[model samples]
Target chain A: MTTPTPRANSGPSGTSDAPAVPAVPGPLAALPDADPAARERLHARLVDGAERAGLLDVAYRTLETPVGPLLLAATEEGLVRIAYGVQDHDAVLADLAERVSPRVLRGPARLEQTVRQLDEYFAGRRTRFELPLDLRLSTGFRREVITRLPDIGYGRTESYARMAAAAGSPRAVRAVGTACATNPLPLVLPCHRVVRSDGSAGGYAGGAEAKRTLLTLEAA
Target chain B: MALRPFEEIVTEYGPMVLRVCRAVVGPHDAEDAWSETFLAALRAYPELPEDARIEAWLVTIAHRKAIDVVRADSRRPLAVAEVPEPAVGGSGTGGPGAPAASANGQAQQPPWERDEELWDALKALPRRQRAAVAYHYLAGLPYREIAAVTGVSTDAARRAASDGITSLRRSLPGRTEQRTDAGARQRRAHQREERGERP
Candidate 1:
């Protein structure tokens, strides 16, 4: 606070020399806080500009569902990353930043259909994920294994050994687990359909319970 | 730590950048400067080090964008020659040429738009002084930071902001009017009209 002890007067009309003139807050002291509508308008413009310039490398959002909040991300091409709550959404996003372009955003316009289909699937009304997908996050044998996930069909379960054999390497069953464990597009790519050879739910990146939830939903 | 999603960055610094842009380029071109600044930033944001001072980095980009706006303004055809009559300000008064004045003056004009006297005084300051004032006062950067951002010496940046404030006080109108209850209420209303915050 200003002490209100005016600087000693060196000039006449000492009435003007007293407490408040210099102590008063100046008009320059602050600016009006940013208008929310204006901020939103500007943000929308920024998003559009970034997209136009091909700088929106990734756009994503979180969807609340029976499984948990899924972090769905898309590139300019298609849906690229999906993360379950246990994957530590923040950590998953950070990994995406490291592997994919760091120019990621939470703008979900790119994921509208993805979100809608997911909602329907969770509601047991739809069983297929016929969405454009980006596979840049997976490569080699892991990629090959996940690429065959959708071929298993809805409401059908395949054992890891059988899924591995279908991926053309029967003995690579554990590798199939690794591939599914790292499946970037888990639910959409149908990784939950893979089960243990003994008919038990296998470990899932979304945790075993989430996998059961998906399988049960499919059965329903 | 992994960089946060870019939306958070935009949410955090967008307003400060807008204010800096307005102080340097005027309200007419401030939004454009802000847009360009953010777009450019989003392009280069991936490589930005997390430890860097985000505010200083944003202000730096805003400074460059402000320059671009000023340059673009100077190149406008209307700027080439003064007509016999300049258009009057505020809404419904001018044609398409005055988009900024009319388009942004909807229900209530931004406080910066209403504070025409402050705008004039700020505009009259030398470009460096204006920038220094904005970076220091509005953005709350230190003199050293102003120097780093504007590429001037610490002493010079300090002098520019200090001198800018000195001149601003002398030339500014309506600063000493907060004593009246009506004046206080009016100022608060203008603030609330444009924003929910004083910062």
Candidate 2:
């Protein structure tokens, strides 16, 4: 640790018996006690005010589930991205910053309705989500595939080839598979509903095990 | 590497920036300065370089925000010069010298609630010296980066920090001893860690 170097070169020469100056604490270490809860409340208010004033372009929060932590993010449009823990939450936020906007904050209050609905879904009370979604992260065929997913209905599964045909590209089975693998919004958009043509569950963005968990939950 | 979430950045650096703000502008204006600094940083975070030193970046933003606060203060109507005596009991409302209540009815604690002597010593330093000490000692910025932020030469930055520390030592003799004792305790703890002993 670099002790603050004393003023050895400058200042009037002192006699040898002068008391030594104590080391200054680091800037952060020197602060008076702050109420963390108050600060958090203050930040939430700031973010909300900023968002309302059109200064904040993105807001995000994490939600806990039986599976693990899920990163939920939104744009001015609506809920945009959802990533499982395995997707690396930090990387997902960086992607949102690059793709959506850098003005992102952890304003959980903005996601209150979304989280409440999600909690209801997880608790097996809600059968559908009525939240607004921003699908700008997906484009072209992928967007079409994601758009078609909700139509597969809750508790129903679809084969990739059949889903590809439903997406207006019957021969684009591989493309549909690619779409599911890279869906920016997973559980909320229901990418786990797509399986292999043989009825074996295919890959999922949240990893194969998470996909299994979601499927089993829906089947029950 | 990609930039982490702005939320993570806030969690990691908020306290440090808050401390810097309070030290530079006093507790009265610290919260506003902090909020402005972060709001500005968030607006530009996407374009920040991948490997940029986040602490330095935040300090630079904080320096600019603190200047803005100072400018705004200069434009405000002057308050009476009398300093309030410290309060005797625990009170949320700031004592006589407390900051005016915020718009939301939040009563910010007065400087006396903390180390008044140290805060007074800090506030008495010349602006350059105060900034230098806060950036170097508080924020841990090197003289080179401090120079960049303060627009002073590196040598000047170092001199200002040194001068500031000297002034503080003179003003708060009792507190200086406490800091020294704390430093010694920390050193002992580090030594214990090196020896694989529990601190």
Candidate 3:
């Protein structure tokens, strides 16, 4: 199948060229279709500095992935955000300020339960999360994409065509891919579990290597 | 090294950050998390080393801010009790949660039940595990970074995440049953409504 053209607003390079759009967050453009484990390692390394800088909360994670640490964060009302990569420091923070709230603070004093819960998860003790999420950041089709992502089974993978079918539009496979690409919260929504019908690893917003790593980890 | 004011950073990466936040928390909470992340970034930016990578720094802040939001929000009662079965929102679904089945007026299932179930599943995992799952599965973080964020050794983090997945897999059967039961009930309710009878 012919590759879908990048979004109209994207630059000639297919990366967002808006002067304000700093280097497209992660190594999305530079990625090559390859092994999952290495990509996971790279994804892990990329986000270290950001986590240390206190830009990330280091909570709300899933176990053993191909990519580096999974940091899921949110607003007081619900999950409003998530982040990846070591270099995502400013990017993650910038997103929160622009989307979640201006009253942000560092104290887990507020996210006490979430922190505790995350601690429990990493300990290999807990399985699921029980948190409220504020989904104000998504709307229209995007919201639909996230809301529907959870329907994918754990361990099992689906193709874009199958995913589109599950999402209720057999014809909108490309749109579903876009949704996956644009997904804000990848794991919680379980986007990595998605693959091409031919079993080829598809594109991921977090980077293809990261995606491969996640798929491998899941397989492991 | 001192970093540029967060405002400058936000102006530059606002949309990307919001996309990340939105990916994790959904749309409704993104605004608040976004605000919190940037504000926190602003307060902490000055302390960052000059050689610091701004993008990573911001992502770290955003992740923390997002956790704060999830924690606080978890305190409130969830709107629904059942977690949705994990389904690919597929490109056909108009994104992830597009009202696909309902869009073409196909056999409509209650989206609320699925939403509740999915949220509960994510919330059910411990924070680190949840984050790992979120990153690898959702945000697509690798084991190494997941280790860094959660303060575990890379292997430990990988194990923790794998363990978490195992747990999800183990629990998924049970959750699927519950979800199925819930879906059946909803379908019955719809049927009841169609019959035009209310007790």
DockQ for all models = 0.22, 0.20, 0.01
Residue pairs with clashing backbones, model 1? none
* Quality class of the docking in candidate 3, CAPRI style: incorrect
Candidate models: Cα lDDT each: 0.75, 0.72, 0.51
TM-score for predicted model 3 compared with the true structure: 0.37
Candidate 2 lDDT over A75-175, as tens digits, reads 77889999999999888888887777767787776688889998988888877789889999999999999887888788899999999899888999999
After superposition, the stretches of candidate 1 with alpha carbons farther than 4 Å from their true spots are A3-25, B1-4, B47-52, B75-106, B171-199
Off by over 4 Å in 2: A1-42, B74-112, B174-199
| Native-to-model Cα distance after best TM-score fit, residue B58 in candidate 3, in Å | 23
> Whose DockQ is greatest here?
1
TM-score of chain A of each: 0.85, 0.85, 0.60
Residue range B1-199, candidate 2, lDDT tens digits? 5577677788777866776787888766676688788878877787899899887899999999999988887797675112332221123222222223332233454333356666677778899988887776666666667888999887788788778777765665434222433333334323333355222
Interface RMSD of each: 9.7, 8.1, 20.2
* Lowest lDDT 10-residue stretch of candidate 3 chain B: B174-183
Q: Across residues A1-220, which tens digit of lDDT does each residue of candidate 1 receive?
A: 3322222221112323344322222645445555675576676667666777889999888999999899999999999999999999888877888788778876767899999999998888887888999999999999999999989889999999998899889999999999999999999899899999999998999998899898888888
TM-scores of the candidates are 0.78, 0.78, 0.37
Which of the CAPRI classes, incorrect, acceptable, medium or high, describes model 1? incorrect
Quote the positional error of residue A74 for candidate 3 in Å.
1.7
Q: Specify the poorest-scoring 10-residue window by lDDT in model 2 chain B.
A: B80-89
Q: CA RMSD for every model?
A: 9.1, 8.1, 29.9
- Model 3 regions more than 4 Å off: A1-66, A69-71, A109-128, B1-199
